[model samples]
Target: MFEPIIPLVLFAIVATTTPGIATTLSTASGAQFGFRRSVPLLVGSAAGLATVTGAAAAGLAGLLLAVPSLQLAMKVIGSLYLVWLAIKIGRSGPPNLDVTMARPNSFLGGAGIQWMNPKGWAMGLGAAASFAALASGPMQLALLLGATFGLAAAASLSLWCVAGMLLARLLKTEWQWRALNIVLGLVLAASIVPMWRSA
Candidate 1:
């Protein structure tokens, strides 16, 4: 039971830090809305990822994995959502709307992006399955899986968001912001690669 802890922690760190749905969304949100304004989105993302991770650990994702049609359906839905996010980000004009201390829709958009991210699914599900196979008790395994994953995810996402904000601030120009959006669009587009690999 305890032996799996090391691997579990490693898995959590790697999965959370990897350039996937959460990372891309956080970075993009940071660029678009700034770090201070992306907190809700960050919280929502963490909540969603934690839910998915918990589900995976509890064998729910395995159930999803069992039904080939269902899995395919989820994949399709997730894929379409990501593509849509990229399109929306690409289409968004300059920041002429309104700038305030308030967090913007980009945060929710980030959470939504993670909700539909296939890589996120893979990470959460894989960690749960692999860790569960090693634990003797269900509750203990679930706690371990959730704690490690949740902490790692939160920290990693904060890094992404901060980096995005810093980059956006550094550029400090309308054109730079637009270019940032394009770069974010490219990142979102690249996120589909892992899904394709899994398929």
Candidate 2:
């Protein structure tokens, strides 16, 4: 049991810490709104990821994976959404840390991103396939996987948020802010590579 659990723990860490839509948004939110205002988004994203994990453990992921048309549709929709998000991020100006001019994302916004994120779906499917066997019962495995992914997502997102906050101090000028936004946006856009390949 212990040995099997170790792999799941490692998988959770890697999945949560990897540079994806959720982490990217969390960092951006922190930079735009600061840590205090970003808490809701982080919590919402964690909860969303947990739900994804549970769905995967319950075999929804497997069904989705088996259907190529659904996968293609998801890829197309997710990619389009990501492109829109990238455009928004790129156009955004440097945040006024003293007085936040740009509004932070809401809890619903955060959750919605996870629901539409192809990367999140992939992570859920991978985790369920790899770790579901570690538990004695189906319900136990789903709960365990969900909790592990949720906690890991929260912790990892918090760290990214802090990193973004630290980076905010360096972006003092308009050009610096624009450059950072463009870079972050591009990085986010690049994350759709897997979806492209799968499609």
Candidate 3:
């Protein structure tokens, strides 16, 4: 019964920790809001991860597999949203010494991102494919996957956010901020490719 849980946990770590849209946004949130204020975003993302994982365990993955059009719709919407987010990140100005930068996202936004995140959907679908045996029934599977993945996401996403906060300290000039923003934005937008194929 418990044999499958080890691999499931390992997969959860990789799924949540991998550099993608969620990590990028978390980093941006940390850079602007710092770790303390970013807590809501982090918690929201955890909840979102739990939802996706649970939904997948509850037959969402099979439903998606049966309907290619639905998958396409998800891909297109998710891609567009990520592109818009990327542009927003790229356009953000350097930090103001005396003033705080705009906090563009919060708990709701964080949860919404995961809902629109192709990578997150792919992770959920992958977990359903690989670890369905971890639990005895659909509800059990959903709960198990949700709890494991959510905890893993919170732990790993925090590291990325903290890294961004640290990087913020060294980014004293406009050029440094500009370069970092462009790179992060590009990476976030580029993540759609693998996610597209995965879904």
Candidate 4:
């Protein structure tokens, strides 16, 4: 039971720590809103990822893998959704966290984002396929996978969020803030590669 724990932890950390859609949003939220205010985004993302990871480990990934049309549809919808999000981020004002600014994303918005995230689905699928011992016999693989991925992803996203917040401090003017935001938006849009490339 404990044999696969070490390898699984390593895999989860490496997989979740990589920069992707979730990290990008976390960064944006942290920059636009303070770290404390962004807690809902982090928590919601973790919960959604955990649910998906657990379900994938329980064999949901294989079902999706077998359906080419479904996969393509999901990819398309997810990509478009992200593009829209990128546009919103790019068009927003500076990271001043002004009271007049529109509200940051809520917990439901954060959770919804993960639901259509192809990259997250791919991560779950990869975890399911890589760890044989995950389903060896204890009937607890889903629980284990969910817990591990959620924690690892949360930690990784928090780091990115902090980085964004720090970057905000370097922007001395409105133009500088706008430029930084546009760059972040572009980076976020570029991150949709996983949605198309995921196997």
lDDT of 4 by residue, 1-199 (tens): 5654665675566555544567778888777787888888888888888878887766743454455355455556645665775677677655433223266677777777777897677667655554533454323667778999889878877886786778656766888767756776776566555334333
lDDT of 4: 0.66
Clashes of each: 0, 0, 0, 0
The CA lDDT at 112 in model 2 is: 81
lDDT (Cα atoms) of all candidates against the true structure: 0.62, 0.69, 0.70, 0.66
In model 1, state the lDDT of residue 82. 59
Give the CA lDDT, 0 to 100, for residue 42 in model 2. 92
* Local accuracy of candidate 2 as per-residue lDDT tens digits, 53-78: 77776674344445535545554654
Candidate 3, run of 10 with poorest lDDT: 92-101
Minimal lDDT window, size 10, model 2: 190-199
TM per candidate comes to: 0.56, 0.63, 0.63, 0.61
**1 against 3, candidate with superior lDDT:** 3
Badly placed stretches (over 4 Å) of model 2 are: 60-101, 168-199
- Candidate 1: C-alpha RMSD to true structure equals 7.9
**Candidate with the larger lDDT of 2 and 3:** 3
Worst 10 residues of 1 by lDDT: 94-103
TM for candidate 4 is: 0.61
TM-score for candidate 1 = 0.56
How far is 72's C-alpha from truth in model 2 (Å)? 24
**Candidate 3 pairs with clashing backbones:** none
